[model samples]
Target: MLRSLVRALSGEVDPEIEARVRAVSQGVNELGFDKWGFSPDAVKHAMGLYAWLYREYFRVEAFGVEHVPPGRALLIGNHSSQLAYDGIMVATALLLEADPPRAVKAMIEKFFQHQPFVNVMMARSGQLTGLPQNALRLLQEDQLVMVFPEGARGGGKTVWERYELKRFGHGFMRLALEARAPIVPFGFIGGEEACPSLVDVKPLARLLGMPYLPITPTILPLPLPAKCSVYFGRPLVFDGRGDEEDAVIEGYVEEVRSSIGALIERGLSERRGIFFG
Candidate 1:
């Protein structure tokens, strides 16, 4: 097949190949291969890859995926743990849970766009710069958009700030209003557990040109084998109300923050599994 040929031609398997495979798989699954006489090989391959990564590296448990509807939806989740594993877990869960299996285009920080090969892989995987223009376009196309309003600082916060949702940016609300998309608030727990910080090394990080270096209780100080969970909240509808004002948008942002916080609390309190088990 052309896909196999393309994969063979590439000397090193890149993330873009995986992205294409995932997109094709999603399309096949949506088309109901059993009834349409189509093949789900790509989807199967992508799922297998994800399963292997998750099983080998992290234990992920997701709930409330049924909350994601078939339409333009904005997913706002708490970004904890310096590595941003929470975002990956949530995206994987959405891909696996949706009946038609929608492909989510995440809004990434501007810095990622400057990375050497990472930018290419992210673009091929449908990631876009966290700009208003791209957000509007995706919403207009009825694509699922995943955004972390707290940005990298929030996600990279120290262990002390774990589970504490930060002040959310208004961009998410504005995008929802512009695209008329329902907002889905979700929470990620145990991401910080994977990479807990033991000391404050901001000064050293500045010298090394790195953001922050977390000292965890590991031999090589890698991300701990923590049990990760993603909890999806009920959708918040726009109600056709034009952007009332900046004040109104701030109010809505607060509501979203509160909702996500509540979900995180619920997930953390109700979870019964260990990080490695």
Candidate 2:
């Protein structure tokens, strides 16, 4: 069981894998089990690695954790870094740095979810697609749901559009209205510099049916060591039926977007340097 969970989360392992497996397995056993396909052992192992990335490598400083209310809540943020490092950092902050240490169910892109190894690992880590049905169900169960409204567009951003937000989908807004979950907006600083997208080959991307293909300097499958900071804003709540008009719901979406945008600007200003915070 331990080996399986580790394999699902990480692609490779070595002699030290046994020690990690033992540690995570023990932690999972103490918690019993969960219904969301969440492998506590997998989460434990992943969190341990992310904690190091968040605390030491990037030297992250998280703020406004208190804004996340109890029960079901929507965590919306500006996504960048060419990868899901922004999402992982947000999850790490709440899991290891928050007052009560809450678990977040991140919404994964359907296209990316089809990858051979990523599929199982994402499910075992309790991440679900950003579908209305999935978000509603998770919120109904009183769980924290994190989403990047910008979706693939945000992840594929070029260097110039780093902090600039793209058009957001109304799906998250509708789900929040249906679940009556408050929205917690967050911003991640220094992520745009971590992997600057210099160019995107549109022809190749179209052939592959992907949004955009970003080409960056970091050739290796690793993010350059860069300092990071995260800021969570006050939660916002909207009273509306899920069937509301697009225009009406968009008003609320814009508000959340604006909040996150402001946080991003503030974080960028506060950052001391790119690699050193």
Candidate 3:
């Protein structure tokens, strides 16, 4: 029954898209047993469903995909919504739209590893804990790594705080410098529509052991669909040892945040309508 509901929400994939997905799924077949526990089959299944949302539901528009250089880059960006639809949309765009599809390994919070089904699915989907060790290793292996510097603060915002970037952790800067990986700052224009949270219920979220428990007013449980636009910026390369002082690293981190903030502003500026991008 739950699967049926998801299928209904996702609708159907066209023949061309189906063919493309099938071809791409073949390359990552062995991803499951790999170090990251990435199950290619599971990824294919999820991608098929996300494709429906990407092409139809949110009508996602991915820009500057070419800016995502191949291999060993840090994908740093803003976060939004309770469930991470913004991140999923960016991942979907890279998988289905980018030239020569690339695999993105995102770092999720460690507490997620405690959840049963979610933990399993997250690992199988190539998500690792947000640890410096894991990030360094991924970059060393020349994989595309993603980190949400905003953490939970951005995801838990109310509608009034929409598109406003929160303070970022500087850990990603150190990791990128140590790994010698370029940092790509990206932005999403309308992810707040995924969960138009109006109330910031901090007390309840504490009871739930969540970062931020948001009271969504727009769609309740099911996320209300809105047009989503993802913009990628040119890669920023930094030269330094990984062990820089916090003050120095903060400067670099701020640069990334500012770039993403500007990108978000541009996307919002050019937006045509709420349901259309």
Candidate 4:
């Protein structure tokens, strides 16, 4: 009622704003207006918007999305760039290629949930709590769960540090083990180099409460025109192992890191032109 009244009083707001509002409302409905949540339809709609925005802003080419399996799987990929365009591209590619059109959910950082509007979009896009319980639930439902095991540091790592896989968190391995899901290792090239941030702006980031503000090279500094490739390696299956046992999960994590690293290296080496060219 209040929402309707607000909309009515606004007298036909901007289309983009309306769409975003509708997306948020849909998320509220699906999440039970609770602490945090997600909906497949809302996620698909949001992804569509992102794909449209990205295509208009930059030339994006994606490959190996066919490698994503139909059932439940954990997508562990290298995190690059302070911005999340890497994940966005991967999600878009999966949407375009997955048969039956699987809904891909990502375990996003907790900070994104702090913003009212940003949280709505993230939830609507099926980006649930990066918490263990939420992750376990999504995987059990047989959903494709995307995660940057390297977390915030890896995602925002400097360009020179791109493709250098950081020490990944073991939560993914635990979740995979608990849910019996396969770990799909993938990598994105050109994301870190797309909009490289040279220095740490801790004070500004703290002021805005944003993890990091990116400093890229394009007008509006969009992701570089250099071709972006998303390469997926064979899925790594997890045996039912005890979570307390570090050795088993460690071995699996190493494999995932190595797989992603190899793909990123190959993608970088195969590039036809320099990033700024």
Candidate with maximal lDDT: 3
Give the alpha-carbon lDDT of every model.
Answer: 0.72, 0.80, 0.81, 0.70
Model 3 lDDT per residue over 196-248, tens place: 88887899878988787777676555777788899999999987987988888
lDDT (10s digit) by residue, model 2, range 141-259: 88899999898888888888879999998888999898989999999887888778898777898899876788888873578878888999999999897889988998999999999
Which prediction has more favorable TM-score, 3 or 4?
A: 3
Better of 2 and 4 by lDDT: 2
Q: Give the per-residue Cα lDDT of candidate 2 at 53.
A: 77
Off by over 4 Å in 3: 1-32, 218-221
- Output the better candidate (1/4) by lDDT: 1
Q: Which runs in model 4 stand beyond 4 Å of their true positions? A: 1-48, 53-58, 203-210, 213-222, 274-277
lDDT of 1 by residue, 205-249 (tens): 678665566666654335777787888999998653546788888
Per-residue lDDT for 39 in model 2? 79
Model 2 poorest 10 in a row by lDDT: 18-27
Better of 2 and 3 by lDDT: 3
Residue-level error in angstroms, candidate 4, position 147: 0.8
Candidate 3, residue 257: the lDDT equals 93
Tell how far residue 56 is off in model 4, in angstroms: 5.8
Each prediction's TM-score versus the true structure: 0.78, 0.87, 0.89, 0.78
Clashing pairs in 4: 218-221
